[model samples]
Target: MNAQTFGPMSGEPVGPAFYLADEEHHADGGGTMLGFWIYLMSDCLIFAVLFAIYGVLGSNYAGGPSPRDLFELPLVAVNTAMLLLSSITCGFAMLAMEEGRVRRTQGWLAATALFGAAFLAIELHEFSTLIAHGATPQRSAFLSSFFTLVGTHGLHVTVGLVWMATLMAQVGRHGLIQANKRRLMCLSMFWHFLDVIWVGVFTFVYLLGMLR
Candidate 1:
């Protein structure tokens, strides 16, 4: 007697079975990059709106403080240098990651975190000084937009610093595995994006505002 093989659901012969390739099971990192890029684009929109709002309300100081009166170029320049330096250090970290030098990558990440923290500190000081002088957001339309724009940027830096720290811990434990590498790359993009945005802020919001 001949016995017939049947499929799971019906009495039909099954064709050859197929399975996913090993490469198909593993991520190629492109999805991560694409998703991060989308996030950056959305963030760009947020910053663009803030920039527009600032442009419109910047002159509406309501007889309160103005950018030239509040902005200290020297301090802002130092803060900008810190963020720019962090971006460089983050690049070095990515290079180290590529080389599979886990410790070196961690060291560079630490340096980047330090620079980022310094930038935040200077920004906080500036904000405190402004608030002390009654330049609170409620004081005028200009102050409202100014704080909204710059404070939002500062908040992003803070989040980046926190993410960097978490990634450092992950690398310390996992030794630059694929997942960790992807995270680092995303963070690299984020850190550099913030640096670019700061340049715009320094120029459009500070330099031009001072001129106005």
Candidate 2:
């Protein structure tokens, strides 16, 4: 037998299967997940600092544009609905991916993106209206804390939209690969985290501001 026909010990050249890309792909996936988790932790730390700052500065009204005067409950209600719906749709996207349904995943992702976009639109409108009414962040300590807390969350949502777009592109290019699924999982966590933070903002900033 030729050397190509078999290994030195087993008399076989091993299975006819060995691809560098496949191996590298798995390694890349693992590294990507680890790096993403580290990034998430760092993000948590940043949010924690922002939250602490908000806690300290939240009550300073500076006699201008208090939350009670500036916050429109009806508009915020719509914004809340948009974000909550997006989270739900994002969850559906994950479910579709888990079932290996690529088209359904894409549909859910599209829906989630639309809802997220709506949330951003409404928030921008709210900010514009407030600024037009002379309730800009520069107007008061209350407005400053309010903007820092809510604007940070809005910025995160904007980033999430970008991330969602990238994920949709990957899904289009690669289908529902394991790596894509893992990334979707991380994004899901991030989306849900933002939802929770919004809850805190609604309760502490909006609702409580009205009481005071």
Superposed on all Cα atoms, the candidates' RMSDs to the truth, in angstroms, are 5.4, 5.8
Q: In terms of TM-score, how similar is model 1 to the real structure?
A: 0.89
lDDT at residue 150 of model 2 (Cα atoms):
84
The C-alpha stretches of model 1 lying farther than 4 A from their native spots are: 1-26
Q: Whose TM-score is greatest here? A: 1
lDDT tens readout by residue for model 1, 33-128: 888899999999999999999999989988888888999999999999999999999999999999999999999999999999999999999999
* TM-scores vs. true structure, each candidate: 0.89, 0.83
Which ranges of candidate 2 are over 4 A from the true structure?
A: 1-31
Poorest stretch of ten by lDDT in candidate 2: 14-23
Checking candidate 1 for backbone clashes, the offending pairs are none
lDDT of each: 0.92, 0.84
